[model samples]
Target: MSKLDPKLAERLRSNADGLFCAVAQQRGTGEVLMVAWMDGEALYRTLTTRKATYYSRSRQSYWVKGETSGNTQYVHEVRLDCDGDTVLLIVDQKGVACHTGTRTCFDTDILLSDSVE
Candidate 1:
């Protein structure tokens, strides 16, 4: 993300609502761990650190997940959607990925879809 190409910069700026959604999933388990938004800085930080980081719209700042909770998401890969407005992260997850101590943020999907993982 070091100085995005002109086309990519335009794309990142165009439809972003000033923020792009980032979804993290466990690669082997196929468990969707969490979904958060990333600004340019957050996106760059994640790529550089190989850790999941996001922008908190409500708090209006950067948030590196697991900084305190120890539920760190070690990013394996990051994919930008065709639209370049969303991102998917394949991660090595540890412990819970949710604030509620659940394995995934979308744990409710277990009851609804029967294939949450």
Candidate 2:
């Protein structure tokens, strides 16, 4: 794994608990898979290992996506939002991206009524 750029690392704006949002998307299809969190170490690990790694807020530990599901996400590229508060990961996903065996975590649909007052 290569070393993380100190300057780049410093540019991130983690919240009070030291975490930033990390969004994963399908490389070519542009399908948003999931939203996770990342601390400095998690971000560094993801970039160095080229795998989608996130900080588990509930578990309070680092989690490599698909570590147990066999649905790994091979990172194609990582981009930082303009404000440096969020990260976007373009990945080649394997199998399902959601734990529910779905291709994406955002499968829920919302309905809007056409009638307006």
Candidate 3:
């Protein structure tokens, strides 16, 4: 049912829905672009295609980043956190990373700041 490697699959710790939190970051700049969820199949597709694919909780389906939005994320590397519950994607983003047409999902949110020091 899952195309992910057995060894790799065993290392992952997914939620009840069998999903892992995936964070996308711009390669060189180290800018976090967006956060999404990935199921085993979505991870498999991303690893195989070098494209950022995520499972949409709302849609209850898989979607490739930029499939329709023209904003794409080309994965360069993937890292699993120590807990194995989060995945970090180093990518080359071609366009906006947020659905709102922003460069990143965090751009509009500023709950805290550097001046807090």
Candidate 3 to native Cα RMSD, angstroms: 1.4
Best by TM-score: 3
lDDT of 3 by residue, 1-117 (tens): 889999999999999998999999999999999999998889999999999999999999999999998789999999999999999999999988988988999999798788854
Model 2 residue 67 lDDT score: 92
RMSD of each: 3.7, 3.2, 1.4
lDDT of 2 at 31: 98
In candidate 2, what are the lDDT values of residues 1-117, reduced to their tens digit?
A: 225677987899989988999999998899999999998888889988999999998999999998998899999899999999999999999998988878898886547646876
**Mind giving the per-residue lDDT tens digits that candidate 1 earns over 1-117?**
444345555667434368888999998989888899987778788888999989888899888889989989898998988987889999998889999888888765545545656
Error of 1 at 21 (Å): 0.8
Stronger candidate by lDDT (1 vs 2):
2
lDDT of each: 0.83, 0.90, 0.94
Clashing pairs in 3: none
Residue pairs in candidate 1 whose N, alpha carbon or C atoms collide under 3 angstroms = none
Q: RMSD in angstroms, candidate 1?
A: 3.7
lDDT for model 3, on a 0 to 1 scale?
Answer: 0.94
Candidates in descending TM-score order: 3, 2, 1
Clashes of 3: 0
Order the numbered candidates by lDDT, best leading.
3, 2, 1
